[model samples]
Target: MTLTPTKLSKSEKTRQAILEAAQTLFYEKGYDGASVRQIAEAVPIDPAMIMRYFGSKEGLFSAAALVDLRLPDLGSIPRDLAGKGLVRHFLMLWEGDRSGIGLPILLRSAVSNQNVADKIHEVFEEQVVPAISGLVPEGEEDSCAGLIVSQLFGLALCRYILRLSPVAEMTEQEIVERIGAVIQFHLDAARDTAGSNRP
Candidate 1:
């Protein structure tokens, strides 16, 4: 007689449960406050299981913390308002706690871990750079891209991560209008710099 294997093994189910519990606790309480035992207790499992599956709390955090940027198509954006579009898009993605959970976790972990730092670099190189490149000239791609990322990420830190009052209270359109101009200016400056360097 032949027998079919179950789709999800008991161990896999337990592992998933542990991660889910950990995410909830981490979200409710900051990462520094959440303990392994607290995470395991929520799942009604031994904390040792988390160590077995993920090696440590940091490892579990890395595996469980994932985010999709859902960046808009840069080519389709209007040339006059690419700046506004970028600001709006980033704010929209970050404003909601549900969609933005991963950013907070990643921002916290990136301070200490090289692997996490590299992962964040990949995120910018892949997602932010490509999205902004279409707005700048071909040769100036790298410099312009780096400047834009720094500005936008700085705004994110002020508004979302640090929750600065003046920045946090402004309406979305107000922020876009204010910040977008700076972004567009840098982009233009980069293109000019690249042109000057050419033979």
Candidate 2:
């Protein structure tokens, strides 16, 4: 059977509706708390249809938490300023998101759900690591990536989740200036110690 453009559009719309509904439900109820039936009700579609589209509730949750870091090209950014650039980019993503379905939501869910945590880890390994891999020294990609992820996610948790006074109240420039240096240190540490073995 030939699938016309209109049919394809409709299918895409249906798929998007399912995802949006699932996102909202997952945000409100979390991974374990949000059921397939609840997601189906939110989408106003049949539970079987959601299963058909996403395979299972776990599948739906995975799709719902999918996040694109949209990290800047490290090669394009100057080495001296790469840390500041990355910090600025992530800050912009957090503060400028209008969809309300960014890292914050995923982080919140990840705190309580192992599956969601795994999904967040997957996103970091897939998206964030590749962006910074070339910028780090040859043998330090994994450690550098881990350090970056820890700093970024810690910032998110303190600023957005815990709402720590100092972190939450810090101006974007202050955050960039302070956290940017820490990130830069991680990026540079590998190169600094590339040939030396520490006891």
- Number of the top-ranking candidate, with lDDT as the measure: 2
lDDT of each: 0.76, 0.82
Model 1 segments beyond 4 Å from truth? Answer: 1-17, 24-34, 42-45, 51-58
As for candidate 2, its clashing pairs are: none
Count clashing residue pairs per candidate: 0, 0
Root-mean-square deviation per candidate: 5.6, 4.2
lDDT by residue for model 2 (1-199), tens: 1235456677788888898888777777677788899888988999999989999887787677768777878898789898898899888877875343646668888888786788787888798878888887677788888998799889988997789999999999999999999999999996777657543
For candidate 1, lDDT tens digit of each residue in 48-70? 98999999988887766665677
Candidate 2 Cα misplacement greater than 4 A, ranges: 1-8, 98-102
